[model samples]
Target: MKSYEEINEKIRAGRAVVVTAEEVIAIAKDIGVKEAARKIDVVTTGTFGIMCSSGAFLNFWHTKPKMKMQRVWLDDVPAYGGIAAVDCYLGATELPSYDPCNSHYPGSFRHGGGHVIEDLIAGKEIKLRAEAYGTDCYPLRSYEQNITLKDVREAFIFSPRNCYQNYNVATNCGAETVYTYMGVLKPHMGNIHYSSAGQLSPLLNDPYYRSIGIGTHIFLGGGEGFVAWPGTQHAPFDPRNERGIPLGGAGTLAVIGDMKQMDARFIRGVSLTGYGVSLMVGIGIPIPILDEDMLYYTTVEDADIQAPLCDYGKEGYPTGEPCVIGSLNYAELKSGEVDFQGKKIRTAPLSSYTKAVEIAETLKQWIVSGRFQLGQPSQLLPGGGSPDRKED
Candidate 1:
């Protein structure tokens, strides 16, 4: 078995054999896992989709008169200022106080926290407003100014939850169309929307979390980042098929990166037609070929990964009950249409597979050019048992 040190040495010498998860499928098919593991040094995987459990932290220099800011807003969207005097965390889903959220059905929440983040990264000037109760040492009560990413003393993206290993395919079964975070679901099983890169997804390639964990270096929104911790609601013990791939949403990741270094293309503001706003994050992770099993896992194809089907309509989803009706493989979901209950239904993906491939290629280039190296995870994700492969 190869170690991380060996992989880095190869990368540094510009002699490493790196391939995207998609490319590895063919390599393994031709040479078999044993030979593929000996020849391949790393496998790159990527995903680009809406990650609502994401935000940024900004540390600003104290304003004149040293006011302890109590309330904060960036471009009319509210931010959490319960921490330090000049620090605020902007959540992706936080909307403006003025937004008439669904009070008028299908509210047009044009701008929110996610847009503010993208504008900041794009070097656009942001209008900042704050209010504070006058303090003994700080006399200023109100403050207003325009700022950009460069103006902040420190800024970073720290997401509580970023990449999900798998997720549910959403549809509507009720008579009325339902507007949810998965997007608008038409009534009576009218349409289906699934959001995962399938075989190219980082977690799917390393299904057991063997190569991805806390302290693992990653590409986040076109910038370098690291896995921070097990994400919120991380449940690695979910039911799985014989290949050890989870059948539903299972493991997740918490990641952090410098916001100033992020690119606008990979970090975007997404406004769901009726579900407010969220950040579209592009993330990539490189999995080291530790053994034949690890290389074998990376060979998984879209046909082998399955997503649970859930109803998001008023009857099943709105009632908050567990509503998984069935399951569908990614190959079927990506085929432009799927056969659900013997009725042909149209299918669409919320996640961008093309962008995912681009991210994977970008990462491979980084490794080939000796610009990036593999990092050994300090701690593996909890609840990951032995991966079951075809040979096993």
Candidate 2:
């Protein structure tokens, strides 16, 4: 009986090929049935599925003896829309209107719809109820070549934290709103800075032309465009103090408004920078953002002031450290005094990509070890897919 390593070497050397379930059992007999069974299960069911779903595969030359391989047969497996079953498991309470023209399900907001959020919120413990429709489950497609039995071994590998670090950065920094300003290409350049005269001048005729010119000194002598609280203040003359300006002419501009209302506008101008980076580095696994406890705040005018004032620094400012304003805050001017409300005004929380990467790596390890599952189904439908229907 050939050892597992020996069989693997033969496959790599193109001396042997993956055949079928029976052939796999034969190989396992050589390496001990228990070892063979474990390898077969991992390869055929675990690894193959992942590769197929993610569209990533290991080359044959890189095959290891214990590694499982998949073979494609000309035969097709039973394939179903799996839509109804998926919807049921996902808690899709409503079905998307089927678009015959597109052959796509335009899902709805019902519990079993195809929305990613619904599934995420549902968590992994939810048992999906399968709904049967016909004798044919679903049409399965076959691969063009047979897989090596060894190549089918599925082992959970932990991805590094860097795999998900980019997502963390983008999400924390308002991924949808940041504009991408690559070099001379300002795709969504806003109403080219109008002067007091409201005249649209050529780039050369612009009032701050020199300010926008090469080496013209960003942020001016004083960090005029920069805005931050006293605790978060930038150096008066530091070039890097140019807050809200793009970095190296390849960053985004910060816009202040209600996030929900501005989400679309922000997404329009910005694209995720770390997406390409992650894919290139082979850390393209998707990582989910967990919902942590939320922090909330309440605002009141200074009790002592005769006129209600919202000014943070005025007598109305909270007694101790002033409450910080954040992306979620509300501000109003009452009686000509600025009143601010939200999480106390402070420096935006610095989300460390390093920490995010660590968590992601841990998740990957869990997945590889069969301790975790990826792409959990949800009960919610895709956004704007369908109206929430109450079933009696």
Candidate 3:
């Protein structure tokens, strides 16, 4: 088995050939996996899309008199103040909806915590406020001020979960156009939308924890990040087809990176018509050519990965509640149209393929310029780690 040590040495010697994931696949198809594995040192994968489970930690500088923040708000959007007296986690999905402000405004989510984070990264200022019960040691009860990324000691995006290994194909069987997170679902299954960069996703390429896991280096919103933990709802052992790729949403990752180093382009705040706000972050990871087996997995094409078509008509998308029709490979899914239920259905990607490629190319340049180095995961993901809850 090729070890990471050899790959670093090859890079250091300037003899390594680092190629984008697409190029690696093409090389594999042309020269076969064995030769491609021997000749290539790294294969970088990328995914740029709207990930709901994302947020950043902001250590708002302590105010005069030292207030123990019990409730935090940024540009009127609420933040989780349960962490530390001066620290809070601003979730991207946190809206500005207060008592009378419950989505009554034309665009409630136009400026959310995600927007604040984006503004901070863009070197702009954001208003911050906190409320606290007066304490003897820390007597400041309330405060209001403006802060930027530079004002915070700890400004980083610690996404609890991201890059779902696979996702269910979203479609509408109802008569009305449904606005959900999976983009706008046209009525009567007239259209379908799927997330993930298909073959270009890092975890999808790894499939198993063979390469990707905690401690793995990655490209996060144009900044370097790492896999901090097995993501929330991680299901590493989810049943897969013969190719070992998970069927629906499966294995995930918890990533963290410096918010200051991020770019506004890679950190966008989007407002869905009815669903609410979400962050579209760009992520890229380089897969080291550990061996022939790893190379073979990296060569996996869109045709090999498949997802289940779940009926979105049912509430909560309950397990086995709706019919599980035939599987559709990403090749068919990305065609902008597909045949489903004996009718032609239009398809679209909420994720940006152009951004995905840009991230991939950027990561490739990092490795080639010796600016980025690969890190081995501390451990493998917990297979079938999180399961559904049951009751009597």
Candidate 4:
């Protein structure tokens, strides 16, 4: 018997390449019952529809010079305890016609059935006997009738039903392929939702449904919901709406909510990228935007105005004696007071509650000076803040 490392080395070195089920069983037989069962973790089949082909083949290359072997695993044989008996078909025709927009109702219904089965296997509550149909139904009049809708439907019902009882059966069967229909269907029954009419309908609007879809397709577990946000295009609620004030304007204030509610775990004063902000934004949940001071306007500083004059000739200025004047002189000339504008333009202390206000004023100045340009918001000001608060 080969050791685990020896088998793994064979696999890695390309000496033992089990690309097909036949190869897998062959290796299993060669390695003996105990060793074969231990070494071979999982054997899966995938099916694809061919447009102009009659036979499909699996191919791979072993780059390792020391190992060169190819193996195939076919389900057509019965000696393998008919393990391939679980294979089912999946096609559009096999599934009931439901509006894709409202398809969630049916999808959820089917998924809920699968979920129940999972819960039972996990020793949870035994809710109900729910199952999903897995039969590949193609367009009836399409060129390929060899794998007809009827064939898929019969394959799903009889094949899976024969292998296991109480499990949902798929009515859409295709060729044995990776991730068999039964393998995919079992987990989904728990997710299906039953309607008042006793018909299966998916829980369409549930955020969990979207999360599951995203999690499955992208292989992102619960925490990976961040990537789902960009795909869903869900935008965070604007605090300005709730406060009845525009951001960067007078009377605007920041709103701070419990960061914990946002699922933001604090780590050494640095919020991890995927935790708090991602969760809040991904699910379209409203979060507190520090709105204590979001907007303010202030007189342009002498440093700001003079800095530009030094870079560009004062040709546009109306006969200015000196465009690039010092701060003290500019303040005195503009305000007729020594410390009026100059003192007001200085950066405020960090302890000040008006930091947001101060920043808004600076941002405005920057925009006016053409030093920066702002991108368009995902949504506009009218939809900017929460609408619960009355306009001030």
What's the TM-score of every candidate structure? 0.97, 0.17, 0.93, 0.14
Q: Tell me the TM-score of model 1.
A: 0.97
The segments of candidate 3 whose C-alpha lies over 4 angstroms from its true place after superposition are 98-108, 314-320, 384-392
lDDT of 2 by residue, 1-392 (tens): 33334433443454432222213324644675444433331111000000001111112222211212122111121112232322111111112233121233221112222121122222222221122322233332222334331332321111111111000001111212222111111112111110000000011011111111211111100111110111111111111111111111111111111111111110111111311101111111211111110000000111211111122321212245432222111112112222124222222111222322332343233334443322222222111111122222
TM-score of 2: 0.17
Give one digit per residue, the lDDT tens place, for model 1 in 169-192: 999999988888999889999999
Residue 159 of model 3, lDDT score = 96
Q: State model 4's lDDT.
A: 0.19
Clash total of candidate 3: 0
Which number leads on lDDT?
1
lDDT of 4 at 200: 7
- Model 1, stretches more than 4 Å misplaced? 388-392
List the RMSD of every prediction in angstroms: 2.4, 27.2, 3.7, 31.4
CA lDDT of each prediction against the hidden true structure = 0.92, 0.19, 0.82, 0.19
Worst 10 residues of 4 by lDDT: 194-203
- Ranking of models by lDDT: 1, 3, 4, 2
Task: Give the top-scoring candidate (TM-score).
Answer: 1
Per-residue lDDT of model 3, residues 1-392, tens digit only: 67888887777776678988778888998999899998888999999999889999988777888889999998889999998899999998888865232355323346676777788888888888889998998899989988877888889999998888888888878777766777667678878888879888887778776778789899999899999999998876667877678887888889999998899989888777656788889999899988887888888788889988765644424345655666788999998889887899887778888888899999998888887888988885676212232221
